[model samples]
Target: MFHYNATNLPLQGAPGSLGRPAKGAAKKPPPRRRRVTLYGLTFSLPLLAWQLLFFLAPLAFLVALSFWTVRNFQMRPDFDLVNWATVYSNPVFWQTYLRTLVLAVGAAALTSLLAFPCAYAIAFKLSEGARRWATFLMVIPFFTSYLVRVYSWQIFLSDHGIINALLGRVGLGPVPMLNNTFGTMVGYLTLAFPLVVLLQLFSLVFVDRRLIEAAHNMGARRLRTILEVVVPSARVGLVIAALFCFILTFGDFVSPLYLGGGNPPTLSIMITDTTKAGQQWPRAAVIALTMIATLLAAAFGAVGYAYKGRAR
Candidate 1:
C-alpha cells in the first residue's frame, strides 16, 4: 500500500486537486433560476393594452374636453372653468344629485334588510335543491335585458296596469307609478332586490354551519343565532353588496328615464341630456368622471373594511 502524508490534504497536490477528480476542465454549477419572461409578459400585455387604449386614453380625452371651449361649428381649446361653475351653480342638478344619493343609499339598505331574511331561509331552512332554484331565479333577471326588465316594470306598475288594478280591487287607491320619483325608486328597488338577496345568500351559505349550531346549543334564539353566528361571518359580503347596489342605483339611467319626469331629472337623466340635447359633452364628461370617482371610493372603502375585518 502506498503511504501518503496527509496534513492538509492538498499539500502535495495542486490547489483544489486533493479529493477532486483529475480533470481537463471544471464542472459548471447548475444554472441559476431565470424568471420565465414569456409567461409574465404574455399574462400582462393584453390587460395593459386594454387599460391603456380603452380606459386611460379615453379618460385623458374626457378630462381635456371638460376644460376647452366649444365653438359654433367645432370645439376649441383652452382650460376654462365655466363647466365646473355651471355644474356647481345649478340647483336642479344639485337637488337631483342629492335625491339620487338618498334613494341609492336607502334602496341599498332596504334591499339588504329584505335580503337578510331570504339569505337566512336559504342558508338555514331551505333544502339544497330549493336553494339552488331560488338562486337561479335571482340570477335569471340578469339574463334578460335589464332595460327591458325595467320597461316591463313600467308596464306593470302603471296606474291602469295589473298591479294597480289588482290593488284597486282590494280597495287600495291607484298607485301613481309612471313618471314619478316614487316610481323610479320602485323600479330601482325591484331590480336591486334580487341582487342583494343573491349576494347575502351566497355569503350566508359560505358560513360555517357548526358555529350556528353552537349558538343554538348555547340557547340563542333563531334571530340571535343569526346575529351572533351568521352575520359576523358574512359582514364582508354585506359590505360589498351594499357598494354594488349604491353604484348601480346612482348610475342607472333606464329606471330613471322610464320613471322620472322628463323635466325634473335625476343625475343619470342630466348626464344623458347634457350629451344628447345640450351637446355639452364636456359637462357630461365631468359628471361621468365624478360618478366614477364616487363609485371607486365606495368600492375601495368597502374592500378596505373587509380586509381590515379579516385581519382582525
Candidate 2:
C-alpha cells in the first residue's frame, strides 16, 4: 500500500491552490462600485452647480438683504434687525400673512376636491386614446400665457360679464364674484386644477388593476373602494398635488391682484406694495423669507405625511 502525503506536496499552479499570483500576472481589477460612484457624481455635478449658483446663492442674498438697511430708497449692506423688527411689529403684516395662509390652504383643499373627480374619470372611465386626448387638452391651457388667461377670466367673471349676463336673464345673479375670495379661488383653480388632475390621473393609471378587481370581487362598492383602497394607494400623488396647489396659490400675485382685485392684499401683493411704497426691499425680503419658510414647512409636512408608512 502507498501512503500519499497531500500537505507535503508543492501547491503552486495546483487546482484550487491558495498561492499568491505569479510575478507577471495582472493585479485584481479595482471595484466597479467606486467607478460607478464616480460616474454618478460626475453626472450630478451640473445640477449641483446650477442650484448653487441660482437657487442657494439667491436665497442667501435674500436673507442678507433682509438684514440690510434702506436709506433714501437705496439698499445699504448692513447687519440690522430693523427690517425684521418693523415687519414683526406691524399688525398689517401679520394680518396679511394670516390671510395669505388661509387663502392658500383653502385653495389647495378646494382644488384637490374639484380635481379628483375629473382625474378619476380620465383615469378609469376613458379609453386610452380618449385619455391621451384629454391629457393633451389639459396641457393646452399652459400654451397660452397665464397672465393672458387671467385677463380673459376677468371678461367672464366681472359684474357685467357673460356668466352674470346669462344669470341676469334668469333673474338670478349679478353676483359679486370678482374682486373677492371667490375670484381668488377661481384663479387658483385655473392655475392648479389641470396640473392636479394630470398628477392624479398618472398615479391612478399606475395603480394595480388586480387590487381593484380584488376589491370588487370582495363586494367593495365604488365609493368604498376609492376611500379605502384607491385613496390610500394614491395618497402620495394626491398630497403632492395639494402641496403644489398650496405653493402656487401661496406665491401667486396675478390671481389676487387681477381677480381678487387686491382688496385685501396677500403676501405677494404686500411684497410689491412694500417695494413700491419706499423701495423697502429689506422689508420685502423679510416677507419673502417668511413665505419661503412657510412653504418649506408645508412641503416637508406634506411629504412626511405622504410617505408615512411602509418600507424605507
In terms of lDDT, the best-performing candidate is 2
Against the true structure, candidate 1 has what lDDT?
Answer: 0.77
The worst-scoring run of ten residues by lDDT in candidate 1 lies at 28-37
User: Each model's TM-score, in the order given?
Assistant: 0.83, 0.85
Clash pairs (backbone) in predicted model 1: none
Best by TM-score: 2
Worst 10 residues of 2 by lDDT: 29-38
Over 14-125, each residue of candidate 2 has an lDDT whose tens digit, in order, gives 3333355634654553332224344456777899899999999999999999999988878899999999999999998999999999999999999999999999999889
